[model samples]
Each structure stands twice: as structure tokens, then as C-alpha cells.
Target: MKVVHVDYRINEKINVNQFYDLLVNSTLGERRPVDDVECLAGMLLNSNLTVSAWVEGKLVGLARSMTDFNYACYLSDLAVNRIYQNRGIGKQLQILTQAQLNKRCKLILISAPTANGYYDKIGFTNNPRCWVLERDSDISI
Candidate 1:
């Protein structure tokens, strides 16, 4: 078997189709807005940090995040093509993301139900108090 030589690029702007394709090929796609190109474009354009993994010019993993650099970082998406899932690319992507932050910033993410164990294995402490307000939910002033 030929060993795949993976290269990691930090904060490089990626083509939307490549990003969309990797998302769809990874397990995270099940929870992403894969059918909406505009939404996906906005996601890439607005994110403050992105780390991507490529093998022979093909995108195989990505970490997309939003952060203030000093307080908190919301790791909005972490995906690795199913074929590349077990080689530590995901952990390295997270590490690269953290490296761009201020020393005090805390990396945070809402684990996809299927990925909680994986996060635990990679040193993420479970925070049980996270709450969410869906975009469609009514709000009171």
C-alpha cells in the first residue's frame, strides 16, 4: 500500500466545492447543511480559522472555527474523509486551530452524537451545561 502523504495548511482559503465534497465524504456531513451552497460559502467566508489536510492535492480533512482569540473559540466543524479518519489528522487539525489562538482562549465544540468518545480520547473535557437556542425558536425581548 502506498503511504498517503498528508499536508496541513492553516488558514488557507479553500474552494467551496472542495470543502463541500470533504464534508459530504466525512461523517460530519450528516449534521451539516450540505445541500445549501450559499450557506456553505458563508460558513467558509465567515470563519475566523480554518485548518485543512490534503493528500496529493485532495482535501481530506478540515477544521473550521470562530473565535475571539482571547476568550473562547467555537469549533464549528471538524471533518475527515472516511478514508482518512484514523491517522490523527483530526487531532492535528484541532491542535493547529488552538495554536492560532491567544493563550487564554478555550476551544469548544458541540460534539456530534457519534463523536463524543473520540473527543474524550483526544483530551476534550465534557461540559454538561451547554445550551442552544435554535434559529427558528421564538425570542422575547
Candidate 2:
């Protein structure tokens, strides 16, 4: 058997290029504002918790989240390079992300349509109560 190592980290500052490259190589690129450098910068700058996976100093996987460390944690983005998927990197990213939070802080995320089964198999239950509000959309109550 071949032994492989994946380094999992917390709060490490990763540059936009590294992050952009990873997203471009992953399935997430399609859904992100990759062409918007400012948006990418803001996303990283605003995230309070970031767990990353590195292989030989190269950014391979990342989990960017926003959390209060007390009540709730919203995992905004979890992406693994397309070539590196299904090797347990994504799961490790989530594991490390949740590890940073208090036990009472429920880790939550809106799964990509393609990733729904993946989250379910990794101990996340389905919750239809989640809602979204796009920037241009109006709130009518």
C-alpha cells in the first residue's frame, strides 16, 4: 500500500491566486465569480475561519467559512481540486473546519446540487429550512 500525507491547517492566510487557482481547477469554478478579483479578495478577507489542505506546499483543497465560534457556522465554500477529489481531502477539510468550532456551533452549509449525496454520507443531515437571498432580489414578506 502507498502511504500519502495531506496537511490540514487552520486560519492560514492563502493568497487570492492560490485560492483562485484551486477554484478554477475544482468543480466550484463554474458557480463562483472567478473573473471578479475584488469579489475573490473580499471573500477571503471576510472569512473568519479557513481550513486548507496542502500537498507539498501546493494548495489542493480548501474550506472557507464564516462562524461566530459559538452559535452557528456556515461553511461557505468547500472545494477540492478535480484531480484530488474522493481521496478524503474534502472530508478532512470539513472535519478540520468543524473542529475549530464549539460543539454547540452547528456546522451548516448549502450543498451544491451535485454534492448533495456527498454531504449526506459524511454525517450532514438534510435540512430544507435553508433559504437564500441574492443581491438583486427583493424581500417580499
Candidate 3:
């Protein structure tokens, strides 16, 4: 399948609604309404570091990072359509997002139980030096 990779350069330029729609329709794990995705997209778009993927004007994937543009970054919401999996689109999204970060920045992402291997294949690894403090066992509120 042919894919179009794009880096959105301006805030408010992408349709947040479409972004949410694609994520929801793709059954990429969680389901989000248009407004929820819109809010998330709005925040990411205003952020200095953000990236997205499209296939002929259709939003198929998205990833965003919060960074100092130098030291460290937290990558969030990396998602690709179920139909588009295994086509290297996920890797391309990561590469595109990484290109916008500073070389000194350490990237981090929380992988789903089944998706860890995929991220590992793309050069993301578990940090031996990091620790997570859990305040609650219930993830769902």
C-alpha cells in the first residue's frame, strides 16, 4: 500500500475531528469520540513538537512528543490503523517525529503489553535506570 508521510507545520491546520475519527474507526485499541480527539489534537498541535501520518488525505496514524527540544521527550499516542499495520507506517511515523527532536533528547513511551516488541524493533528500549511509582492499581476511572 502507498503511504503519504507528512509533518504538520502549523497549529490549527489539521482537522482534529478527522484525526479522532480515524483513530476511532480504525479500532486501534481504545475508542475516542471526535471531541476527545479534537482536544488532544489541539494540545499537540499547539505544542512545538508534533507529527502525524496520512494516506491520501486520510489520517491513518499520529504521534506527538512533549520536549524541551533538547534534553528529553515523552512520546504519546502512537497509533496506526489496523488495516495498515505491518506496512512500516508505524516506523515511519516514529522516524518523522524523531527528526523534529534534538539529538540530546531521550525518548520515552509506554508500550502496551503486546506492542513492546514493535517499539523495541524501532530502537526504543526499556530504561534500566528509570522507575515508576504506582499510586493506584486501577487504571480505569
lDDT digits (tens) for residues 1-141 of candidate 3: 655454333122456666666567654437344456556667556655657666667766777667786887777567777777777777877877777778877778777667878878998877666566676766775
The C-alpha stretches of model 3 lying farther than 4 A from their native spots are: 1-12, 26-42, 128-141
lDDT of 1 by residue, 1-141 (tens): 447889999888798999899989999788989999999999999998999999989999999999998999999999999998889999999999999999899999999888999999999999999999999899987
Most accurate candidate by TM-score: 1
Give the range of the ten consecutive residues with the poorest summed lDDT in model 2. Answer: 1-10
The clash count for each model shown is 0, 0, 0
Higher-lDDT candidate of 1 and 2: 1
> Any runs in candidate 2 off by more than 4 Å, and if so which?
1-3, 139-141
lDDT of each: 0.93, 0.92, 0.67
By the lDDT metric, which is better: model 1 or model 3?
Answer: 1
Q: Sorted by lDDT, highest first, which candidate order results?
A: 1, 2, 3
Query: What lDDT does candidate 2 reach at residue 45?
Result: 99
